[model samples]
Target: MTHHAYADRRSGSRTHADGRPPAPPPLPVAARRGPAGRRLLTGLFLVGLVASVLPWWLDTPAGSLTDATATTTAAGQITGLLAGYLLLVQVLMMSRLPVLERVVGGERIAAWHRDLGVTLLVAVLAHTAFILVGYGGLTGRSPWDQAGVMLREYQDLVSAFAAAGLLVLVGLTSVRAVRRALPYELWHATHLAGYAVLLLGFAHQFSNGTQLFRPGPVRTGWIVCYGLVVAALVWGRLVGPLTVNLRHRLRVADVVAESPDTVSIYLTGVRLDRLALLGGQFFRWRFLTRGCWWQSHPFSVSAAANGRWLRLTVKVVGAYTGDLRDLEPGVRVWAVGPSGTFTAAHRVRDRALLIAGGSGITPLRAMLEELPPGAALIYRARTPADVLLHRELDWLAQARGVRIWYVVGSRNDPGPRQVMSPDGLRRLVPDVARRDVYLCGPPGLVEQSRRLLRRIGVPRRQIHVGTFEL
Candidate 1:
C-alpha cells in the first residue's frame, strides 16, 4: 500500500480529525529492580578491587618503596593482580549468566566487556614491561635479558608469554576495522581464545607472584575467585542451555519467506507453554543440520510467544543465514536463551515510541503485542519493497490502537529527514518526551535517531536501545 493510503486509513479509523490518537494512559509503575541491581553489582566490583590490593598493602611496609626498582616491582605486582581480577570479571560478563542478563541486560554487559577489554590488555602489557624493567635494574641486566631469564628459569613463564601473545592477537582482531573484515565464524573462534588465555596464565600467578608464591589467606581467596568463575561459566555456558534444550526439544516446524531476503522460521517443541520468554528477547540457535550444527547465531523472535510455537525472522545477509532458508521441517534445534531486556517489563513509562530501520523491525514487531494500547511506531526503510510485515502491522494498529508510519525514502530525501527530525517527531507525537523510546536499527540510523530524540527532550533513561552486537 502507498504511504498516503495508510495515512488516510488511519485518519478514518480510531484517530481523531487531526489524525492523532487519544492520549496514552498514564505512565505505569516503573520497574524498580534495575537501579538496585546496578548498585549491588557496583559495590561488589569495588569490594573486589580493594580485596585484590589488600595483600600488597598489608604485606609491604611504608618504607618499602625506597627506590625506583622497588617501586617498579611493586607496580608490576599490583597490575598483575588487577589484570587477573579484571579478566575474571570480563569472562563473567559474557558467560550468559541469567542474573547478569536479567539485572544488567545483554547490551550493557557487551558494552562493559568491550570497554574493559582495552584496560585488561594494557594492564597485561604494563605488568610484563614493569616486571622486566624492575628485575633487570635489580640484577644489573637488560630488560630483554631479564625476560629471557624468567622464561628459562620460572615455572609456567613460557605459558604466560604465550597467553600474552594470544591476548594481543584477540585485541588486534577486535579493532573495528579488522573485526568487520573477518568472517563472523572466524572472529567468534578467535574470541574463544580468551578462555585459553586465562587457563595458560593461571599457574604463573600462584607460582611466581610475591603475594601468592606461598600458601596464605590471599592465595586461598584468589583460588576461590577462580573456582567461582569456573562455576559460573559451567552453569551459564553449559548446564543452563543443556537444561533448556532437553526440556523444550525444539524442532523446525516450517520456514516461510517474508520478503526476498527475509524468512521466518517456525519452531515447535514439547511443552512450549512452560518456556519462559519475553517478546523482544533472542536466542542463540544451533540448527542440527549437517553443515550448520557446529555454529550458533543469535536471532530475536519475530513474533510474541504464543504457547504453541515460536518464530524467528532473519535477513539472509551471510552464508549462515542464507543456509537457514533451506532448513527442512522436523530438524532439531538447540537454543541458548531468552536473553535481553528490550521488553515491556523494562520500560520506564506506559507509553512507548518504537523507531525501527530495515530488519531492525523484527524485535519491535514482537514487542507491539505486549505493549499497552496507544503506542506509536515509525518504521524507516529505503524503499516500499523493503518494508516487511506491513499488513500485519496494519492489523496490529487497529487491534491494539497503535499509530504506525512507514517512512520510505533515501536517507537524504526531504520526507524522511523531516519526519525523523526533532520538530517533526514532536508534531506527530506531542507527548513523545513523556514516553519511553525504543530505538533499534543499523548503527548509523540508531545513532542519528538517538541524537534527534535527545534534542526533543526525551530523557536518556527513557530511551531504551536494543542491540545484538556482543
Candidate 2:
C-alpha cells in the first residue's frame, strides 16, 4: 500500500507537497465539558445517597438503639442501603452511556468503577456480617445458626446468599494480579456475573428490608432508581450500538499488515459525514465472522476520520487480535462507539507533548492531525524494526510542523533511561511544563513517564493518559 493511503484525511481542501491533505485546526477548549460534568454527576450521586438513607433515619427513633441487637440491626440496615445504592453507581459508571462517556470520559469512569468495586464488596460483606450477628443475638443462637435459620425461613434469602457469593467471586477476580493471570476474554466474561448479582440481590431488598418491606414512596423511589439504571444499560449497551451499526453499515474495506505483529484494518461505511467522530476516540468493534462474531474489542482509529474511511491499527498480542489479521474485505463490522476524551478538544494547553510506547502511537498519530502546530512526539520502541508507521509519522511532522523523536533501546539502556528522565524531557521539549502531556503505552512505561513528567514540574491535571485496559 502507498504511504498516502494512510495519511490524515481530515484535511478539507488543502493539499500538500506529498499530495495528501493538510492537518485540520485544533478543537476549541470550550468544547470540553469534563470539569462541569464531573461536578454535576458528583452532586447527583450525593443527592441520591441522601435519599437512599432518609427512610432509615426517619423510621429509627433515638430510643431504638437501647440494646446491642437493636444497634447491630440498625447498622445492618444502613450498610444494606449503602450497598444497594453503590451497586447502582457501579453499574451506571460502566453502562457506556453516551452522555457520561462524552462528558466525563471513559477512562475516568473506568477508574471510578475500579475504586468503587472494592468499596461495594466491603459494604456487602459488612451488611451480611451485621445481619447474621444481630439476628443471632436476638435469637440467642450462634451467627452461623442464625444464618441457616434465616436462609430457611426468609423469602428470597437463598438468592441473596447466592448473590453474595457471586459478588465475592467477582471481586476476587477483579484483583489486578488475578485479572492479569486470566485471559482477557475469561476475565471479561466473569465480570458479566455482576449483572446477575444485582438481579439475585434485588428481591431480597424489598422483601426483607425494614425500610422497604411496606409499600411507600421509599420503595417506589428505589424501584424507579433500578428501572432507570436498567434503562441506561439497555440503551447504552444495546440500543445505541444497534442504531449506530444499522445506520453506518460499516464493513471492512481492507486489511494491511503494518508490521510482522501488527495490521491496520480499514473500514468504510455509508454516510460517513454523519459519524461525528474525533481523533483519539475508539469503538468497540465486533466483526461479523464465524470465529469472531461474538467478541467485541475496543480499538482507537489510527487515522483521523476522513468522511470515507476509518482505520484501526492493532497489534496481535492475543488470540482475539491474532484473528483480526486474517479478516477479509467486505466483512461487516458492528461498532459501539466513537468514545473517549483523549482528543484535542480535551487539551489543557495549546501545545502538546505525546509520549507513545509500542502500539500506543495509534491514537497519538490521529491526534497530530488536529492538534495546533508545534506539538512534539516521542515514540519509544525497543528496536527500529519494532516502530510502526515511521513513514506516516515523518510525513505528518513536516505537514503539521510537529517535532518527532524516535527513542529506541531496552528499558534499562542508558540512552532510553536518560531520555525519559526529568532532565532529559526538559532538554528535549524545553517547555514540557507548559504543554499538555498525553501518554499511552504499556503500564510500566506510562507510569514511569508520568513520574518523570511530574518531577519536571508538570501538573498532574496537565497529564492525560490512555490505556488498553477495560
Candidate 3:
C-alpha cells in the first residue's frame, strides 16, 4: 500500500514555502448570535400565533356565532392553522442551514427538532379529529362516516390522511425504544419519509384550508414559507454535499488503528482550509466504497483541519462502522459539513473545563489543541486501552502546559464514577464552577454532568455539550 505524506501528522497549522504557518481561515459570520436572530425567531412565533386567529377574525359569521357547531368549526380551524405553522417550523429545522446551526447549536437544534416533531404530530392529530367532528356535526353524520366521506369526496383530504398515517409511523419509530431497536440505515430511510409527509401537508392545506383558498397575503405567506424551507433543505442537505465533494475531491489517504475497535480515517483534499471547520465540529461522512456507500455516519474531527488532511476517529459499534476498519486508501468520500457549536470560539470564561468519555474524546481532543491556556481536560475511559489518542493528548498537555486528568476504570470499578461525581469533580478542579465547561460523552453521563455542574453553581450557558451519537 502506498503511504500518503499528508496523513502522517495531525496539526492545525500549515507551513508555506517561507516556513511560516499559513494564515488562519476566516471566522464564520454566524459564530456570534446577536439580537437579530433572537428577534427573528420571536417574530416567527408571534406571527404564527396571530395567523391562527386570522380566519376567525376575517369571517363575520364566526364573530357572531353562538352555537356548538360554530365552536367546533372554530376549534378545528385554529388547530389546523397552528398545525400547519408547526409543521413548517419543523421542516425549517430539518434543513440543516448553517446560519441557524451556528446561531443555535446543532444539539439544541436537534433537540428542538425532536420536540417540534412530536408537537407537530399531536397538532396534526388534533386538527384531523376536530375537523372530522366539526364536519360531522354540520352534516349530521358520525365522525367515522364523515372521515370516509371526506377522504372519498376531497382529493386533498385523501393525501392528508395518507400524510397523517405516515407521520404516525414516523413518530412511532422515533420513540426511543423503537428507534434503538431499528438499524441505523432502516431508521434513516424511515425518517426521510418525513419530507414527503411535509409536502403532502402542503398539498392538503393549500387545496383545502379555508384561510388559504383565496389569493391574499396569508396564502402568499404560506407559499413563500414553504418555498424557502424547501430551498434550504435542498441546498443544505442535498446540493451542499455534492458541491463540497466535487470541489474538494476528497479521498481516503490512510486508516490507522487507535484501538481494537477504533480506527482513524484520514482524508486529503484540495484547499481544505476553505471548509472553515473548527476543531470539535463534525461531518456526516459517506465513504463511496462497496457495502458502506449507502449509509452516512456522523464523526467528529479528531484533530484540526490543516488544508492538507482531515481526520475522523470512529469506533466499531455496529456493522457499518466495523466495515470502516477495512476501508482501503483512495476511496472517494462525500461529506456534509463542519457542523456543531462545541468549539473554542464559544468559550467565554477565562478558564476552560473539557470532559470526554470513550469515543467522545474525538471532538474534545481536537478542542484541546485549539483552546488557549488555562484549559483542563478530564478523560474517562473503561481502561487505558480504551483511552484514544493519549500520545497526542499528553503531548498537547505538556507542550501547552494544560492539565490532563484521566479517570480510567470500568463501570464495575467505583473509581471512574466517583471521579465524575460532584464532590470528586470539585476536588479535581477547584474553580470548576467559574470555568467554561465543554462536555462530550454518552447521554446519561452528559446529563448527569450537567446536573452536577448546575448543583455546584456552574451557569447553564457556561456549560456546552456535544454528542457523537446522531
Instruction: Specify the highest-lDDT model's number.
Output: 2
Angstrom error of the Cα, residue 61, model 2: value is 1.2
Best by TM-score: 2
Ranking by TM-score: 2, 1, 3
Q: Lowest summed-lDDT stretch of 10 residues in model 2?
A: 8-17
Better of 1 and 3 by lDDT: 1
Full-model lDDT for every candidate: 0.85, 0.87, 0.80
Candidate 2 to truth, TM:
0.94
- For all predicted structures, in order, the TM-scores are 0.92, 0.94, 0.91
lDDT of 2 by residue, 1-470 (tens): 32233433445321223655455434433335336667898899899888878889988887879999989988899999999999999998888999988887777788889999999999999999999999899989999999999999996999999999999999999999999999888989999999998899999999999999999998998999999999999999999988998899999877877788888888889988798788888999999999999999999999876788889999999899999998988999999888888887788778999999999999998888888879999999998878988877888788789999999999899989889987888889999999999999999999999989988899887899988877
lDDT of 3 by residue, 33-114 (tens): 3336646876877787687567657754635557887778778888888887787788787788877776665667778888
Number of backbone collisions per candidate: 0, 0, 0
Model 3 alpha-carbon drift over 4 Å, by segment: 1-8, 11-43, 52-56, 60-62, 412-414
